[model samples]
Target: MSHHTLPRPGASVFVYEWPVRLWHWANALFILVLIVSGWFIARPLPTMQIGEATHQFVMGYIRFAHFAAGQLLTVGFLGRIYWAFVGNHHARQAFYLPLWQKSWWRDVLHEARWYAFLESRPGIHVGHNPLAQIAMFLFMVVGMTFMIVTGFALYAEGAQRGSLPDQLFGWLHDALGNSQLMHSLHHLGMYFVVIFMTAHIYLAIREDIMSRQTMVSTMINGYRSFKDDDAA
Candidate 1:
């Protein structure tokens, strides 16, 4: 997922570093928790009359996990943004798009063709391909910011005015005007994240099967080994 196809000969290259690998896994786990708990909160399970009021807190625990995961996601994201500045060039790929470059857009189209089965081979690069870069920029970066802001804004309501969440995210209420709309948008954001995650996993698997380099394993161990000598 990180290294380029060999420019010269056969050997593995280290691409993702420890921080990136660690954050990738942690962020993924946090997102999973958020989605699962968020859904239950939105459409709660049926109440059990068999239990006394003091004996159970099923919904309460679900809401707590949702809130906890949201906080973790926010913190992890902020640290990731910091890594974009301090980490390797590959680490910064998701933070911005190369919209001004014509060749970049051409390669993006090439990637599209590769996915569509129109191209015989996909190109390999040191970092993300152009298409993946743009998708990450828009979906992960921008979409994530949207989710974090709206989520905290909703949390701020429960925290009451003048609390830290309110002070930090209160502007979202001013911009959106209605709490229900914010809730709806946050719910929609979950679907967007799920869609992206599905596509990301599929593309990783497809590339692992078709490409010259290690795809999924590269993220896990921070190195990418080429499977072919053909120039990517």
Candidate 2:
């Protein structure tokens, strides 16, 4: 479950705390690094005979970047989960759905209408709107978990038998019974994360421009400022 605070119109509320903001930007950077390096790892550059073949390690560097980012992302996600327990109410929003509450469902529909242009004004939200909440749950929480599991499983294969990665996540390979299939699935999962990132950026900019409250700056400075005096 999650909670929301209703602030007076034209008031500025501290919504995202420092830890949340740091995780937001750091997660973005880590995902960006992972995506670029993962692509190159899938289709490496042609061999350049400029240096001794033994000395050239272009693919090695790319894989290292990918692996490092993956590990960082995993640790960051775990910390986010821990923060969900100890931080403010908003910090827990991404982890669960309040499906039993009719008000939550109504707000979800209201947000959908606003996004669809059926409504001129959006409802004020101190943290994520219901639609954005659901999106984050799906794309960031569930999607990231899927990627991490599959990613480490793939890494385990390269690490070989009796390695830490193999011990921790290698069962995934046995469960799937085909390494190429795992590769394909992991590649497909990357596209989903990319799609989410693109849509998230577009929506943040759109809301900042059209909504009556802060959007992008809230994530940066942790305060959500209302643009008008009308009460929700």
Candidate 3:
């Protein structure tokens, strides 16, 4: 008698949507290009006229692309924010919350130990690991806030002296001391973004290597191959 093999006990039921994946990679590329171009504009270290003109042109293009990409990223951010409130348990608070403080702390320590090569198993998670969750949240806040403030500042510069944009950011400009200060703050924030981006890519690559699963691919495909018994 022929025997039938049962299907796998459990498999991923949820996957990332096209919009989410597109937003992720597109935003990543846009931010990288923006950062590189922005840095040269902020500080022309090599002091070459040709480089300066090229930098200006590149930065101009980057600013336009950044604005367009920012809009797309904003849409993705808002959609995800809305989803957080109404999505499934896995996609809602569970994904954002730290599980339990003790558990999360333990996991944090486990991560530290794992990085130090002190733990044998080091525990893998399906969703963002605790450290990643926190960093991601911070990036979202800093990135969005910086974009809003700096964007308004730029708009204010082109507005009539007493117009709304001017009025709104005028005090901020004064408090910060000048347009130069605003520019500096905006530029500094990009450094934070770059640091976050570096860590994010490194961790994703590390996880993919260690787990034999594409951590980056999850953002693309939305579905990760989680173990049957893994908790959401």
Question: Per-residue CA lDDT of candidate 1, range 124-226, in tens?
Answer: 6656778888888988999999999999999999999999999999879989899999999999999999999999889889888887667898899988776
Clashing pairs in 3: 16-222
Query: Could you list the CA RMSD of all candidates, in the order they appear?
Result: 2.1, 1.8, 6.8
Error of 3 at 185 (Å): 1.6
Which residue pairs does candidate 2 place in steric collision? none
| Per-residue alpha-carbon lDDT of candidate 2 for residues 1-232, written as tens digits (9 for 90 to 100) | 1235666677898888898999999999999999999998888877778699788888888999999999999999999999999999999988998999998998898889999899887887877888999999999999999999999999998999999999999999999999999999999999999999999999999999898789999999999998876656
| Candidate 3 similarity to native, TM-score | 0.72
Give lDDT for model 1: 0.86
Best to worst by lDDT, what's the order? Answer: 2, 1, 3
Residue-by-residue lDDT tens digits, candidate 3, 107-196: 777777877789755455656666676776677555656765685675577565799878886667777778877887788788788888
lDDT for each of the candidates?
Answer: 0.86, 0.91, 0.63
Worst 10 residues of 1 by lDDT: 1-10
Give the best candidate by TM-score.
2
